[model samples]
Each structure stands twice: as C-alpha cells, then as structure tokens.
Target: EAAAPRQSVVRRVAASSELVQNVAELAGIFSCLEEAFMVYSTRKAIAIDELMEGSRVSSVVEDVFYVLRKCARRAVATGDSDCACSVVNHVCAVLSQRLYVELEMRVGQIGRNKERTLDLTREAQYEGLMEALAEQWPMVEGSDDAVNTSSASALGASAMDLSTVSLGSAGPGGVDHSVLGDGSGGMSSTISAEAAFWCLSVNNVEAAADNVATVKATLEEEVRLVFDDELESAKLASCIAELDTVRNDFKKRLQTGMTKLCASLSPRLRSALGVMDGASAIVKYELTEAEFADNDGFNPFVHEFLGALERILAPHAAVLSPALFRTMVFKVAGYLAKQIK
Candidate 1:
C-alpha cells in the first residue's frame, strides 16, 4: 500500500520508464509532436522561400507572420523553449535586418489582407516589436530544459495567443532516470547512473516533444498522402503499411543502431557496462514485431539502448552543450524525403 503513492510519483518522473508501458507511451507522444513540428516548419519555410523569391502576395506576409506566431506558441506549448526562442528571434531578426521599410514602400498592399495592417517599416516600430518581445519573453514560459532537440522542433507556437505553454514552467526537471558510466576509469557506475538520470530528467520535456513531433509529422503526412489527388489511392494506402514497417524496423533496430553510434564514439559504452563481449550476441538480428512480442531482448537490449543513450547525450554533458550540428538541414531533408515522390 505504501508503494502506491511512490509508484505514482515514479510514474510522474520524466524519462524514467518503470516498464514497457511507460517507454512505449513516451515514444508515442514524442513521435506525434515531432511530426506536427515538421508540418509547421515545412510550411513556414516554403512561405518564406516564396516571398524571398520575389513572389508578391500581400497576404503572404500576414500568413507568414501568422505562422510564426503559431510556431512560437507551438514551441512553448510543446515544451521546447529553444524553438520558441529561435522563432521569436528569427522573426525579430528578419524584420530588423531586412527591408520592412523597402517592402512597405514597394510591396505595398496588393489585395485586402489583414497583414497589410503591419506597416513594420519604421525603425521605431521595429525597435518597439523587439522591445515588446523582450519584455514578453520572460512571460512566454518556455521549457526549462535546453537539451531536448525534439522540443526545439515542435515549438508549440500559435498566432498571437500562446496560452497553452508557459514561458518557463517546471517540467521533467526532477524526474528519475536510468544512468550508466563512460569507460574512463575515473568515474564509478553509480556516478554514471546518477548522471544519466539527471540528463534524462532535464531533457524530458524536449524528448517527449520530439517524439510528439515525429508522430504528428507521420500521421499528418500520411493523411495528406491519403487525401492527395496527386497520389494514386492504391499507392497512397501503402503509407500506412510503410508506417508499420518503419515502426517495427525502428523498434528492432533502436538498441543496435544506438550501439553502432556509440561504438563510433570514444571511451566505448560496452566496456563501461562490462558487457563488451555481449555486443555480438546482443545484435544477432533486427527486431521484428514477433520478436518484440516474445519478450526476449528486454534485459540485454535495454542495457545497450541506455548505453547508446549515454553517448547521444555525451556532447551535451558540458555546462555549455554543443551537440547535433546541422540538425535543421536534416529536418529539411527529412521533410522532402517524406513527400510522395
């Protein structure tokens, strides 16, 4: 009976999975959030690209800014403060640096669109916007964690009303996490475990957001593909099958792929886990749905998975993290790759 409250508390922690259910649930959430981000991001990029190409649509500016507003709110709501900050900063930069003045003079108002109201050409107006955003930044309530890349992607942004997310709310900061050690003889497994625990806790909001992004992207794209006239319905239906295939493939390959990544890194993981020899036995084959159902690889696989997790997070361990360069380009590529070609 005493364990009940403790169990709930455990359940509340970010990045800590008491069992398979927790793991699966977290993964599902993040996947959806990530996919939403993809849609938001893709559309935003496309619109801006069109504008930059000198395609004059007066409402384009309105739509573009409108999307930015949503992107900002989405970033915050989805638990990605970085994304929120990035979008806000980016808009500010664009308006400040570019010819908001020249555009107002030249582009003018083509047709009646609400965006025409935005005569952001003056330096004073631009300065005011920057100032207003600065003042409002604190109130925006972005995620507390910076390490979660997925959170950065989704951005929980909305138009002018970003009520869903707080500028700096407490999320996943105190959650429990599984930990492991790096192979330097200096650190203890206990220490390593505790560190990993902290890492996951801090990054919980972002990680969850990232997973949500993936899910949203896949489902939305799948739906679009289904409804799209350009796609042959019979071929379009295969999107679902492709999803299942990817799901099974990803699940089976999670630990092994991670292991491969870790193996490429310095201070190898297997050595630290004291499972260096099992690496071969560990990845005899890729996991399929049937194999996952058998409950066969949980123990060994979990170890390898966590090991990889540690490596993925290694570059982030610094007080000032410098991880995952060129992540945006990858997102763009991912977006194009998902299109029905």
Candidate 2:
C-alpha cells in the first residue's frame, strides 16, 4: 500500500514535468514565429520600390498570410490547442500592429494631400493674379526702392480685393478659373504620386481581406485534418473567429478609405461645375437672329468643365481597379445629381 502511494506520487511528478516541458516547447515555437513575422514585416516595409513602381498592392499582404498558413498548419500538427491558439493570436497582433497601421497611415496621407492641394491651388492663383497685374499695369521708371514699394502696395490692395471676389466671377481683372484646368497651374508630380500611393493602399486592404479569408479557410481545413475529434475542431473554429475579426476590420478600413477618397474629389468637382455657373450668368439669350445663327451651337463652358473633370479623374481611373473605379464613378454621379437638385 505504501509502494502504491509512492508510485502515484511518481506518476504525478512525471505528469507535471511533461506539462512544463510541453509549455517550454510551445513558448519556443511562439517566440520563433513572432521573430520571423517581425523580420518579414520589417523587410517588406523597407522594400517600397515595388509600390513606387506601381504595384497595385503590397507584396506583404500575400507574404504574411502565406507565412501564417504555414505556421498555423505547423502549430496544428503539434496537436496542441494552446500552441495553435497562441500562434493564431500572434498573427492577429502582427496584422493589427503592422499592416493595419501602415494602411491607416497611408489613408491619413490623403487628408494631408487635400490640404496641400488647396494650398498649392491658392498659391498658383496668387501667382497668376500677380502676373496678370504686372501685364495690365507696366512698372514705372523709378528707383528700385520706389518700384518695390509701389509693387507691394499694389499687391496688398489686389489681395484685399481678391478676398471678396467670387471664384466664378470673370472680367478683365477677374481671376481666371481656366488656369486651374491647364497643366501649367497647380497640378504637380507630387500630387500624382500621393494619389497613386493612396490607390495602392486601398488595393492592399482589399487584397489583404481576401488573403485573410483564404488563409482562414486553409488553416481550418488543416486543423480539421489534424484533429480527429469534433470537440477539438469546435475549439479551433472559435480560434479562427479571431481571423474573421481581422478580416472585418480590413473591410471597414477599405470602406473608410474609399469614402475619404471620394470626399477628397468633391472640391475639385464643384470647382469644375462653378465654371458652368459663371458662363450661364453671362449668356445673352436676347441675341439677334443673325448672331444666334453665328453661335455655332458650342458651349465653351461645358467643354471646359468636362475637360477639367477628365484631367482630374484620369489618374484615378488609370490606377484604381475597375470595380473600385466604377464605385467612384457612381458616387460622383450621385454627388452631381444631389448638387443639381
């Protein structure tokens, strides 16, 4: 009876030791995976040349998920739910911390661009106004200091006058909205590059969502194959729910990014439409029959507005996916209809 009690104690010690060893092994696996994922993410972050070269989505979207699948399968093969759960949770952490943050930052850049674009537009308009003024009033022959004083006073007066003038107004001294349409004005390569990166960020979110679903399905299948017990599979299904949350988060970000992009285009669209308003105001419906006959039925404002819109949207259409492009078009159309109403 004493020997039986001693044997029981020995068995208990062996069980405890095995549990500790298993936990240590699992910890090692988790550490290795975490380190590997961090390295991969860092490498991809540094290698942004592909994004600059017009890759629609970051390669990390595919690469990280690819690694996740392999790691999840390996964890499942161990037949330990703790190991599998730890690894899956780590995957979610990596995605939330790394990929999601990167995407959010990229979308944030769009907001900054909106302000920068407006500032550039204002600067260009100021420059155009100064040029127009210099042409309209030639500088008088005088001392350099006198000329400077005269120029500064004229600019200050013009700036004050411009502050009250409507953007749509046009006359001999009025600001020319047409300048905004021409390539020589405010549009720059930097703006185009920012737009391209925004498109890529949006595409990356979409691609990442799809990849997450794919990886989840693959991991689930592997889990089922590895674990014969229904209860164990149920536990894994619960674990996989974490991935579903990540995918949903990605979808939400995608929608947010698209909405922001559409909103950003609104000011430009309104400016284009403003040209039509200005033209309509100056239309002379009481033209003589002979003058009407010579009108040639051309609406210069409509043509100008459309040309400006095409210039504004051409880069977006070229970069965005067809589906996304269609969504943007529909949204723009709805916005126009609302404005018309």
- Please give the TM-score that candidate 2 achieves against the real structure: 0.62
Q: How well does candidate 2 score on lDDT at residue 238?
A: 88
Model 2 scores a C-alpha lDDT of 0.58
Task: State the C-alpha lDDT per candidate.
Answer: 0.32, 0.58
Candidate 1 structure quality by residue, lDDT tens digits, 4-108: 998778757743646745645554565456445544554554334321111112233344344434543443343332333343344333332331322322222
- CA shift at 139, candidate 2, in angstroms? 40
Q: Total backbone clashes of model 1?
A: 42
How many residue pairs clash in all the candidates, one count each?
Answer: 42, 0
Off by over 4 Å in 2: 1-49, 52-54, 113-191, 280-308
Error of 1 at 181 (Å): 11
User: Which digits, one per residue and each the tens of the lDDT, describe model 2 over residues 1-341?
Assistant: 78999988996887689787887686677757665775576446424313323345546566666666777777777787767777777777777777777667565555342333335543443233223322322221111111111221210111121112233323222223332232222221112334445566687788888888887888888887888868778888888888999999999998888887777666556655655345333335577887676556544434444445444554455456666766766777688779857
Q: Name the best candidate (by lDDT).
A: 2
Residue range with the least summed lDDT across 10 consecutive positions in model 2: 154-163
